[model samples]
Target: MVFLHARGITRTVELPDAEPLHILRGVDLDVEVGDHVSIMGRSGSGKSTLLNILGLLDAPTSGTLEFDGVPLDRMTAGRRDRTRGRNVGFVFQQFNLLPRRTALENVEMPLLYDGGRGFWRRRRLAAEMLERVGLGERMAQMPERLSGGEQQRVAIARALVRSPRLILADEPTGALDVETGATIMTLLDQIATQAGAALITITHDPHVAARAQRVFRLSDGVLHAEEPILEPAA
Candidate 1:
């Protein structure tokens, strides 16, 4: 089943004093449920721009985007916000958790925008998500109290608490040490796999790209793919 599809996508950013920069030029892509794709590119190569468009954080200057068969070009901002929250989860380089909030509270923040679930149920779900991310012991710890890896775990917990069908992670390991980065990716890969959510990660490191099932390289707003190695028969 197709979870997300974009065709003939193009995005242009205008500048006051110079020519407009085209970030994505006729990029086409498709992602089904549970597929993990890594988009790798150098800085200024439009990898992050593509991710932002895919996550609905920014709209394409011109193109068609469909999420679960729903067209995105015509959606109002308010509707888009709701749809994004309900269908898409985001993990960033910076954990972006509130400094003053406890881990539990941070995980519960997404529920505040939702109205259907009651307070107790939201609390329960948040706690469960924290446990799943291996942060149950740090539920009461604030952001300052947690390590970089632990904070990213809390961010992942926050993203998963919404039960999103798609997770878009932008440089999720950018701020951590080698050991912590590996740990974060291991936890995220496990969590995303268990949930059967499609994962789209954008990164500059080729090693990071190797972790995904398929990898795409972006240059001049276009995509290129290297032949993937095949595993031996069991």
Candidate 2:
């Protein structure tokens, strides 16, 4: 049931005239299908670096990374790109929507790389996703016209439009008010659950991190699991 696996993963960046800056050190994680996992860290704690590695956007300097049991290092560059595009979706702190594009068109962007039924029916599929996010009436609106929450919804719809099996959200609620952020997180969880996709959220907010079934904290290049909070029975 492990959809993505990482063990002893390390990332280091060498400076021109100084010692190497270590971002991640021997981090290990296993993400299963339909799992909701969260990683909490301060601004300089390498949360984004870990997320990029988990999403296959960056490779670890050492150790192993696998997706669906296939080793990432074993795949060719082209295959890796295709695998990531087909299976992983990303939501960022900033909505990252194209300012000029309509909400529907933004949602359709990912399908353009599909080169299959999704590509052929991009508009319809995008519309359906937008509707699911409760943005059907505003599908034609540009990013500027949408409020912060609405823009994030468009981003979420765009991320899910291709029906990715895994969703990586980096500070997804960072830019919103508390109420809107809570609403967005609930919507994200519901949609990911409906799609049977694994969710990994990286955030500094404990309230945000608490939404995940499992939580880990990253500090000084190391990741440690926090004890889960058990709810009281009714």
Q: How many residue pairs clash in each candidate?
A: 0, 0
Q: How much RMSD separates candidate 2 from the native structure? A: 2.1
Reference-based TM-score of each model: 0.94, 0.97
Global lDDT of each model? 0.87, 0.93
Q: What is the lDDT of candidate 1?
A: 0.87
Best by TM-score: 2
Badly placed stretches (over 4 Å) of model 1 are 118-120, 229-234
How many clashing residue pairs are found in candidate 2? 0
For model 1, residues 107-207, the per-residue Cα lDDT tens digits are: 99999888686355888999999998888899999999999899999999998888899999999988998778878888889988998999999987665
**Best candidate, lDDT-wise?**
2
- Candidate 2 local lDDT, 1-234, one digit each (tens): 999999999999999999999999889999999999999888988999999998889999999999999999899989989999999999999999999999999999999989789899999999999999999899999999999999999999999998899999999999999889989999999999999999999987777787899999998788999976343232
Model 2: pairs clashing at backbone N, Cα or C within 3 Å: none
- At residue 18, candidate 1 shows an lDDT of 93
